[model samples]
Target: MGAVLGLLVVAAGCARQVPPDLVAGAPATTQAGTPAGDIAVQVLRRYLGTPSENSFPERAFPTVYVMDHTFGDAADPSGKQAGGAPIPAATQQRIAEALAPATKVVFVADRETVLEHKESCARVKDDAILITLGPPVGDARRVTVGVNGFVACLGATWLTYVVQYQSGDGWQVTGTTGSMSIA
Candidate 1:
């Protein structure tokens, strides 16, 4: 009987304890998959040249921007916008082709549509032209890429992008949005 009691005590101690805030039927918390910010930066770098190079061309209009989206404030482009550079036409094409395999890109022409979608969609929003990327079915992840023209200073714009995946009950931002600025 002593041995049985000892075993029972050990088993009881080993049992998992739920935190006070967690309800009995609550779904188990899950960590996100691979970070989307790192992937986005890597992809951009693969297409565009390194920082040392004169990546932003002087005459490129509506320049291309890529940011980490995990650091700075999405509202103020100047605050969090980190790397701003222009992407050459060829490089832009390459980026599209490369990202085509995993992401479905949607381009929003005007600011109103972008704002509308950002407001309506069950996701966070920033002040930028929205580019929504839908993952293939069963992926359970979505990426929103945005570019705000003339955000920080004259002739400057910023890119704010976010990666989110479904959590236990709802979707959550995996990491903060990454941003880039170009002038």
Candidate 2:
């Protein structure tokens, strides 16, 4: 048990932290000192790294609402992800069994924003998104991509993912999702 705990600590320590750009009083600014675009990419990458083949829903769900900036809104007040029933232990074990080859994927930030759009749904006042991290990403990029999922970066983990995109404009993210943990 002590060995396992030590390993977990060492693995968690591997997380990378990159200083984020801050512009206070600016709604477009990154939150908690982390860039939204970077966060999106990091989450996407971690998900891909995991064994399970949880895929992102087809972009078929068109979201017409776009704002000039992006932000993170706690979907769960305590920041716990809800709605999806608890994953079964057996299923998790199966996922761990079918691990995919580790590969690096890159995403660039083309445009990101947060907006409330009422044109799409009426049940709520408007559609709300915590953040929108987009990169003008496509097939031409050097890094490879596969089915997406989430990775658990437990306690105090910080991630810095940089993607080299066109026009020499690179992208970066510097934090971990608080809820991304298997324990």
Candidate 3:
């Protein structure tokens, strides 16, 4: 476990991105077994370095990290909706499998189960990470997902990244479309 800090759940933009130099190694190259799984792992890795994934990068979260399987009440980054819906069981399994290599202790379960567990943790408001994945569209070379690091009722952020295949580059995060944060 690490220190508990503020929350930051990000809702990303369409495709506007930061320079490649800033994001460095954002390529989807992992043993997650599938493209979506690979992308999810990579995106989570970006946040795991922090306590609430964005705001508390310096604080250490002092327990096993819990991820809600379904998007639950998380806002949709697609702009076509508000909260996200449940992901297929297969998709959940794939992403969960890929999460094993993330180093930090983590587990994926239903919202109810995760919420129940969260209630029993030392820090209730600043733990759980809710996740949502946008399926592969077009040529299946591009994918996006949302990560919500809940640190408190108000402290949080939402940032969405645009990941695309660059022919010889494989699946890489070309840019971030948008981001919102609160502390």
Task: Give candidate 1 misplaced runs (Cα > 4 Å).
Answer: 1-84, 106-113, 117-183
**lDDT (10s digit) by residue, model 3, range 1-183:** 001111222344343221111121333322222344445556555655544436765654443344423232232333332332333344445545655543444444433343434434422323544333333222255544444555444445555555665666556666555454544
Per-residue alpha-carbon lDDT of candidate 1 for residues 72-176, written as tens digits (9 for 90 to 100): 222244443332222223333443454554432222223243332333342213322232111111122443333333322233434433434545523333432
As a whole number from 0 to 100, the lDDT of residue 173 in candidate 2 is: 25
Per-candidate Cα RMSD to the true structure, in Å, reads 20.0, 16.7, 10.0
Worst 10 residues of 1 by lDDT: 1-10
- Local accuracy by lDDT, each model: 0.29, 0.23, 0.41
Best by TM-score: 3
Error of 1 at 116 (Å): 1.1
lDDT-best of 1 and 2: 1
Off by over 4 Å in 2: 1-56, 61-63, 69-169, 172-176, 180-183
Q: Could you estimate the TM-score for every candidate?
A: 0.23, 0.22, 0.52
Per-residue lDDT tens digits for candidate 2, residues 1-183, read 000011111143542211121112222213233332332344344433332222223311112111121222111222222121121233223222333233222211222222223244212112211212212111122211111112111111112123333333433222232232121
